[model samples]
Target: MTVFILVGGVFTGADVWRETAARLAAAGREAHAVPLTAIDAGRPAVGHVDLETHIADVTAAIDAVGEGPGREIVLVGHDYGIHPALGAADRRPQRVDRVVYLDCGMPRDGVPPLAAVPDPALRARLAARAGRGETQGELAPPATHEEWQRWGSTAGVGVAALDRLTALAAPQPLGTLLQPLRLSEAVAAVPATGVLCTRNGVGIDLVQRLVDFGDPVAAALAGPRVTFFELPTGHWPMLSCPAELADVLLRAAAGAGHRLRPADTGTPPAHLRPFPLDVPEVPRDRKGHVDLYVPGEGGARPAVVFVHGGPVPAAARPTPRDWPTLVGYARLAAAEGVVGATLDHRLHDVADYERAAADVTAAVELVRADPRVDADRIALWFFSGGGLLAAPWLAEPPAWLRCLAASYPVLEPPPGWGLGDSRFRPVRAVAHAGALPVVLLRAGREAPGIAATVEAFVAAAKDSGARLELVDVPHGHHGFETLDPAEETGPPLRHAMRAVVTRLTG
Candidate 1:
């Protein structure tokens, strides 16, 4: 059988599935990782490559790989790649023998990919980002390590393998996320399997939850023709647990008639459970709420407060407490035996940088007052816009503040955004950073202006005797935390988060 592997969304190329392909090839199966037109080496795709374009790309790959008369094509799709995989199967059911949906959305006719996202807020956020003119409808990756890991589990992969995948990820075109898959009912006839990396069945439960909430794709996975197989890993099993994923794929391809196994029904780890939401820090204020996630066996644990990116237009701002990525990271931190707190601060238009700083300060006080939290050990994590607001704290941080982490932070105003305002220049704080340790995580592929500002800050911090460490994500872009976190970027994100947690807890 000729196995055609299609990778997930974003700037990802076929290289994301290299391990799975090589393993299948070693097992004596014909395997090919098909690169989509948007990411193909020599194709050089231009503006707005839609679903049809992707379908054509996959169709051509299928035709090229299934050239032999006797060869049977097994189509495999990961994440957003499922749309094209199914589209190809619908277009050439006679040529395709099996279809595998690997921890991805299983799209049907008419519904676009973004419309199928279970969360309405997330769908809107994606659309809003696309509508922003200068961005040209391109979405960057998740901006932080915690957000990246929360997007997918990468516990099973080695550092080298994860890094290789991260290096290959690119900025995804918005059209691909918005395009509807043109699939036909005939696709049902092709043998299909839904390979879920549930990490001890949480994925299964989440799917069932979405189905209960009326998600059509989740509802379709519950269909009779689709066999569900669970793998105890994160979303990107091809990178996290490739050997086992390959085994399952090979078994399905060989027509072994495998069935869904009994999933682990034990209590999920603390981090995976639903954390307490909308706990008020400032009881009288409507927007002064915070979400807290605590580890199962916690006892006066250290805490890390997450400050989200923004200062965005009021009309487009989201309630930070409800953000899935932030909430997930809080839960993940709790799972790691740290108290994770995600807070909401005033927007730039509503309050100056000082007011935002005060909001974070109030949040820290609230956390410190909690009986379950270690009052003496606390850390602050800032992303993008939040980085500027954190300047005062970084300059003259409280004795109790253990560490500070900033990811792709806007330490200085963009050239056109009132650079004359010293209030917004976080670089000035470097001289006052003192002996307090700071972790600065930057994307190597960010805008030149942002890179230059960060470079200046790093140089200044070093000369000022501030104990600072810089972690570089070579292939990532600005706001990576909000983008699709692929296997390649997971390790660095995890590493950065762990370092912060260690410093604060120690």
Candidate 2:
């Protein structure tokens, strides 16, 4: 039998993996814990890691084990470590009997792993501060309670040391973080299991049981050839509930031997092979993939594009909380006989929004290239953070746009708009204008200082003879609470969006 390799995740060290290895060793089973350089958030001395590097490290461990003894291996990935495990397993599927994901899952095709978390702005902010690298792709953790506190209390490490570590940390490749894991078809066929730590849901303030189960680790419960078990502990079960965690893993391992193959219940209609007909079909990047869901229309239709903001390569990474808003917005635009495209633009803290504006302009060119699209009739609709990326255009409207409808647009990047330094430095950055018709929406309860920025943009557009429709919105930071109707939220922002869309397009 080969050994089971445990891959350590964010802020987690060999010690975390060691705990599991110790348990496995005590059980008289072969196991090897592999730690690939992401622990020590305070000391990001190690170079940056995309899944590829992490994958290489784990694959080397398996090869080392295989060379030493001919033991069948079962791989384990905890937290961010799952990236490397999946990458490695994709290479050696048969040699490994199973791959166990312990609370760590990567985006499957288009979205980046870190980008999938709903409202992950907080985490992304921390990753940059913690020196995890620019892409926020690396994870080695204080995944457990003690670990989190330890990081907070580690004041002894000199600030100089911290700075040095941060300098050593590297940036994530543009697309890998959002590029979705590319796996051999064989890897998906492998029997895998997920062990979820419920501590996450508890801390999150409002995660339901089903939502927790839908997590990557929990996705196994619904995905084929995979099983899921949730534990009410922090993200790291090894430290929070090692004994129970071990037991769950052992049982899941036992269950893996019994493959479930039954008669088919039913077959899907041809139109629904993978998804619904309204799904927006967009073009792909180098990987030949696009995250936007554009409806398939046999004839030409007016086209509209969606450009998301993150200043990160995988800007289009899906947000769990925004599913309703995105789908609804897409549906609304599609119903208007228009093609919708949500673009994944390049991002960085030191990003030049003007460059992003140019990127959006190129995307518009692409949309215009297709005969299926009425290039001259395109409408630009965006709100909240996405509005920031397009704000630069208000002064210098993109040449191809039919018109621009923006809500709560932040004309300039606020002092701390997630980027360490301000990229939208007033004058030089935002110079888009010239008799363009535009609609501006602002949250009534927006941050005091932010309102000025919004006003400035509106003023600039007006100064340039652009038609500005100012609508006072009674809402919060992101306007997602409005898109998904069935969802219950405090106020109604959807009404605000509808009003803006109607004024801009109608």
Candidate 3:
């Protein structure tokens, strides 16, 4: 027999798990939903309730359930609930078989939930409230559906559920979000499951990409015991799809979710797949920082600079210039009678974008100085995460810069990236690109958050009357050149590439 323990997120109580709990019970599993100190409806919340207080609540639930022979426990936590759940699990690893992270980021040591609050205005307001000692040192729940969106997407939730959620919402103690969650080495021994909510912006494919990019945090998730599952609904799956959530929890407990394979394990990773078009490789000139592939041994011709997207791990082998996609594109451009250049930038993390931009600028200068390249005619093409690097060039176009192009580019940084006020926002910077020709290749099946940024950039481009040419790959995914090799992707990719090459040479 397996006993399941559920912990709710901020402003929520055990009652939110009612429907899901019933389903679990019907399936012959015992489920207990822990009502933490601040949000318990049976009693008034004390002003000083904190994360430790919630951890105690969960530990108490575990004790009452009583671990014994033939009886195991699966600890499940949703959003902010993951903090206390992790703390309690760390304290009683012997009693926990698995810890399910439900629609939330993996909690880090010494970092509070408040630090990652998605809404800037709300985060500032909460800090101000705490500073002023208001609301009895508590943070109130969102009052309306619109307000709730700041927390997470409400794609699959209903009006009735939303109303009930608001009515049952309690004020969360400020300390719960402010206090850092402490864990021990014991928690790492227990296997883990990640339940991602796709509509809210995260999905298994995106997680896989992050792991492939050599992100340390994401890499940690590729451990053998950590598995993943993605739900099509939004943040609050317990409310939106309780039955499905219950099923997933049951499946997770049985260790039946998808396992992630690290990039090294793949013979050649997805991004390293063979290029769609067969073009002979042109010998690369690696004299400077930028790798240059000149067309013919003749007069200087126009150039196209290709930027590979990443906050890619600095340690990943076979640098960007050697990637099959990048190398193939460069070869293709050279075969088409133009110079193609690729450079490895230092976008090792989100915070390093500024440094990466400097590397790119320096590489451009080096590429321009090459006698084989026509310095006055150049087009810059960016991909994926490198999309943000285009902002400065877009905001203030140079005389030698003829055009800009991006494939499945992230136009704006997502929340919690600490780039809210960054100048790297192409959605905002596109407005400043008065006469600059911009080519955008959009992936229809892109991750929701990234797709939203692309849409915003498109809207901004329209509003500004920017010289933008859009190519839509309706059935493609991000890294479509390698991920989706269907004929549909071929046409749009070539069209976008041609659009840039023509602008550079014409």
Candidate 4:
């Protein structure tokens, strides 16, 4: 695999990617540090570059790599480099295998980089400079070590590296910052990953803030194709954590050939093993523990929290940590390139809905804190009796939650299940179901009592304008996967699983 590195704005030359490129080369991969034409160290970029010019520069680099059948290229873009890299990918989708956005803004069709700038004054100034026919303008960097520390660059980069960056900094083309990025839907099809710099405080929340502020680039970042990895460093990972960054790039490249969408048919990938982490959120009891399934891959992946059915006899109820069906689901999720977690919440008899909700909350926090998991792209999967406890999440879901799935769920409060707690009623929770999409899987031959409740809950959710997708299993019954894993039930169960996976990943 050939990895193409694009440096950020206001920085000239490919020197910034030297450490990262050397690391990739050591791993037996070819790395190309492609320099932007007008933004180079050889001369002043006073009147020579724009968005189109940089796009052309990247396009030339892609051409030089010699694209053909079975030839794979991974585009790595840092900060402002994202614009040109995406534009090049849009122009050459078949040639580019994957695109990685490193602590940068992801561009959408017709949205300029200036539009996504958080500060209105800076945005207006850049726009005005472009309008005034200024070919280039200096993007001032921190002049002093104290200012550099305040900017979060000194945390990861040493004095020498910081000095090198300062020496290599160049003036950026005003027109390039102002030019609207023209991308096609084909760019969306390319597998994409975002390397978030957490130590610099840049993560999913920052992306969401941009989305909430109506930035198109931020909106695109929220899409399904973009998986995320968190690096515990400042913005300049190339200078500070090159080996780690190279490993992340390698993992991304390895998975680039797989289809972004979950397979509709076929046995899952072979290596479905998970690295388990047992977290005791409540007490020493097994019911208070949560098991996180980290994929064998090296980079961060999205997460799914599995909540199992319960409130039965202790011997009859399977332990959440060792349940075969849940473990199989987690393995399946890992095979599909996502982190999976099975959590144990308090049984209904031991506590009310509030306590169960608290357990789920704790599980979510645990998942978010894992370095191998993307805190933003999390989904909650509730099965059978556990759905009621997850009702609060559906009622007022967090912004980071992508979507949720419930299979053969007990949405309505049964007579003894809730212990007379009114808050356990999932039917009432529908009214507060925010815009988060929900997948409801209903077994066709379910018990009449359970079927009636599911129907009532579905009706209420529809009336409340909740986004819902219902998958009906025509020949299966409740807990079909556990009770009967034969041909009769396997197809429908897999179908429901695929649907939920698609919704969650997307």
Best by lDDT: 3
Please write out the lDDT profile of model 2 over residues 140-201, one tens digit for every residue: 32233232322122222244433433343333333234335667677877788766553342
Error of 1 at 203 (Å): 4.8
**Taking the tens digit of each residue's C-alpha lDDT, what string does model 4 give over 1-506?**
55555555444468888888998899988888877765676533545567888888788888888656556898988867888889999998988888988876556788887664433445567778877867465556546555444323334788898888777766566667788899988888998888877655344433443343334334555556666777777668898899999988888777631222222224321112222222222211122477776667677778888887654223323445565567767766766667778877765432345677787889889888888788888888888767787677877788888878888887875432213334667788877877887888888877555676799889999899998888877766666664543566556556656766676677
lDDT of each: 0.68, 0.51, 0.86, 0.68
- Give a tens-digit lDDT track for model 3, residues 1-506: 88899999878899999999999999999999998886987756655787888989999888888657978899999989999999999999998999999998888878777765776657778677656755347677889877777677777899999998888989888888877788878898999999998777667987887787667778878899999999988889999999999999999999989988886785777877888777876998895668999877988888999998887878777778889889888887888789999999999866778899999999999888888889999999999989999999999999999999999998887543546677888998999999899999999888877888999999999999999999999988888888886587778877887888888878
Q: What TM-score should be assigned to candidate 4?
A: 0.47
Top candidate, metric TM-score:
3
Candidate 3 deviation (Cα RMSD): 4.2
Query: How high is the lDDT of residue 208 in model 1?
Result: 46
Segments of candidate 3 deviating more than 4 angstroms: 26-28, 41-47, 68-70, 110-115, 119-147, 159-172, 214-220, 264-266, 283-289, 296-301, 346-376, 388-400, 411-434, 443-475, 484-492
**How well does candidate 1 score on lDDT at residue 453?**
70
Q: After superposition, how far is residue 137 of candidate 4 from its true place, in Å?
A: 4.7
Model 4 clashing residue pairs (backbone): none
